[model samples]
Target: MSTETVIPKVEKKHLENPTGGSKMEKVPGKPFMEIHDEINDEGQGNFPLILDDSVETQTQEDVKPKRMRKLTSGGQEMYEKEVEKYTAELIHYRKNLYILINSYYSGELETLEVRLMPDRINKELSKYQQISEKFIGFLKRYRTAESAREEATQKIIFKSIVSKAKTILNEIEIKLKQAQLAKSFATGRKFKPPSASSMLIKQRAKMDAAKTNLRFASKEAEPERLQFKLEEEELKTKAELLKKKVEAKLQMELLKSEKEVAIAETEFNAVREELEMEGSRSSGKSMASVVDPRQHIERYLQKQQEIMKSVYINPQQMQPPELNVHAAPFEPKSEDIRQTNYEINNVSVANELSKFLLKKESIDVSFYEI
Candidate 1:
């Protein structure tokens, strides 16, 4: 190695350079919007802002329609649809009522059915009234709608509704009167069933005494006590029939329950087999899910069913909620008309229709009493 090692000397240069040019130096500035606020000219109203023509056109193109202060449009169509619906419902009700009343007038209807007509008419009328009231309320709320055609149509429709309601009311009044008159004549015309001893003991005793007197006075071969003995035997037969009816109804209910159980078992078995085939066991994820509570519950029930299938269950702890349905017995159409809920004293019928009288019964004596 040489005594003097070749050492590279670093060169130093003094270089003066200006700061780098700014990136934004070449960018154009935004146009300034000048606002004039001169105080001297006070007589003239405040001048609107004068925007550039291009800027004004662009803003106008981008502008959206502003909301109206009131309902100027869009509600008329919906209102008309509601009116049509109301009209259709009212027409149907009127048609049904007309058919019933006319049938009664023509002697083509039963007295019992005629009695029911007024109630049916009144029910329909009440339903129509509710619809009308609802419509009136809706109309009241929308009276402020600024559409001229809408306002005119609403007035016309309202007048029509008022007229219709008045006509219907009158028609119902007439029919109700007809019903009341028919109902009045029907009083005491029904077949009076023998009263049970428990229901009316005093009435029953009075009736028995009256019947005994009639039987004695009339040409009956048997004695009064013998007639009562026969009646007791007839009552026993009626009781037996009633018991059989009760037993039959119970048997039917038992059959229904058994059928439901069989169906449930079949459905459960099918579901279990299907699940087994799919290898789709009810996982913990399927047992509970926040997204669908009903689906989770069904899965849980299915899991329980699977468990019941695999393991022996003594009895289910919970049962389905029972609905207590009380079916009303169909009473025979009795001519013995009961008083209705509403008063009918104010109601009146036509002179010709109101003259409904009880038929004159004729019983000529075949044998000479003298």
Candidate 2:
């Protein structure tokens, strides 16, 4: 048996086409969009890179959001310069578009200036697309960096350009509409259908007819109005006479009320005077009759002194009778003498007894038959 030689096996890869196809058969026409990548020094793309997808995602994550910034002097100057540069071409195309749309709505013939608006719009769009491509490339560089500040600045610039494009498009549409309206107004052509315009015209006619009828009606009523005015004047005269008579009667009533008020005032005064006189007379009589208590007491004391002088006699200086009071020591007798005739002068004996019994005192006695 002979030994077999070793063989190296090579694996083949079924590579797709350059345009993402299975084969190299070219498509019939240019595709709407194309993406190609050729190897570079850094293995980056040779064809236009698909930076948008990667940058957009990274930018959304890394970039700080834009805030409203106050424009600097330099920024303002730059903005003016940019405006001046772009405005000439834009304004030219805008004017042409305006005239075109205006005349179209006006039902007027199209001029050469107006006819060129579409081409101008397409050309501007192409130019904007080319600028956008460059702007997008700059944005990719900013997004790859880690600095949020620089990324935000780049984003602002990019957004400004895009916003400018949007504003231009919006302005174009607005101007077109304005031109259309202007043309319609100038030509007196109704923008709406005949039925709508006819309705408005009919409403205006109705208003005019109403106004005319009102005017004629007013004219026809003029004679009747004159008659009404004359009657009103006559009624006013009669009312004036009636008002005068009522005023005179009211004046007479007011005079009578005044007289009654005066009489009542006089009666009040007379009553007040009579009360004052009576009060004065009563006050005088009371003052004359009023006596002080001290004077009355003094007069009573003088009268008592006179009565005492009339009744009292001079005290007789009679010597006191010898009282044979035996002040011997008290003795208890064998038999108590029951003398019944006992006379007591309470004034003399009563004061002499210092230790008098504190009760109603009575004496009981009997005469013994001897």
Query: How much is 164 displaced in model 1, in angstroms?
Result: 9.3
Number of backbone collisions per candidate: 0, 0
Which one is best on TM-score?
A: 1
For residues 307-334, write the lDDT of model 1, one tens digit per residue.
Answer: 7788974466656768657867667543
Per-residue lDDT tens digits for candidate 2, residues 174-259, read: 65678788887977854555688889999999999999999999999999999999999999999999999999987776676666
lDDT, residue 51, model 1: 17
- lDDT (0 to 1) per candidate: 0.44, 0.44
> TM-score of every model?
0.24, 0.19
List the pairs of residues colliding in candidate 2. none
